[model samples]
Target: MMLEANNNYDKVHFAVLAIGATAKAMHTAPSDIYLRLKKYNLVKELLFDCYDTLHAESIEGVVWNITEALKSRES
Candidate 1:
């Protein structure tokens, strides 16, 4: 349905926002951040899966969460 398609679009949009914000906060390229996230499966597991709760959070909060998530995955 149209609603489901819209929801998917919204989630993807939010994911891109988070990636860019996180890249800025980390002083890295968005593409690098995106690749790391994809490597760790965070793009789907963390971004899309948590879209409902994360979309409501502040950009700073989202960036912190993503940074922490990436750090954790590095271990």
Candidate 2:
């Protein structure tokens, strides 16, 4: 369950990173990039759901999983 949650976060973060990189390469403003990214707010919500479901064991675990996933993708 935890692994699944992590994977969900990974997928979302990966997409965001890819989009951000593309926007940067295109010389787009970060705000404009974010505006486009906002279309995926639903995806962010779904990721939260996955975290809640898998980390029912502890809120901290869920946060940690998501943080790790985002850090992995961003860095």
lDDT of each: 0.96, 0.51
Q: Pick the candidate with the highest lDDT.
A: 1
Instruction: Please give, for residues 1-75, the per-residue lDDT of candidate 1 as tens digits.
Output: 999999999999999999999999898999999999999999999999999999999999999999999899998
How many clashing pairs per prediction, in order?
0, 0
Tell me each candidate's TM-score.
Answer: 0.97, 0.40
Which digits, one per residue and each the tens of the lDDT, describe model 2 over residues 1-75? Answer: 999888777666754654455456547764554554355452355344453464353434443444454445546
Cα-based lDDT at residue 6, candidate 2: 81
* Model 2 Cα shift for residue 58 (angstroms): 36
What candidate 2 gets wrong by more than 4 Å, as runs, is: 37-75
Record all residue pairs in model 2 with backbone atoms less than 3 Å apart, i.e. clashing.
Answer: none
Best TM-score goes to which candidate?
Answer: 1
Point out where model 1 deviates above 4 Å: none
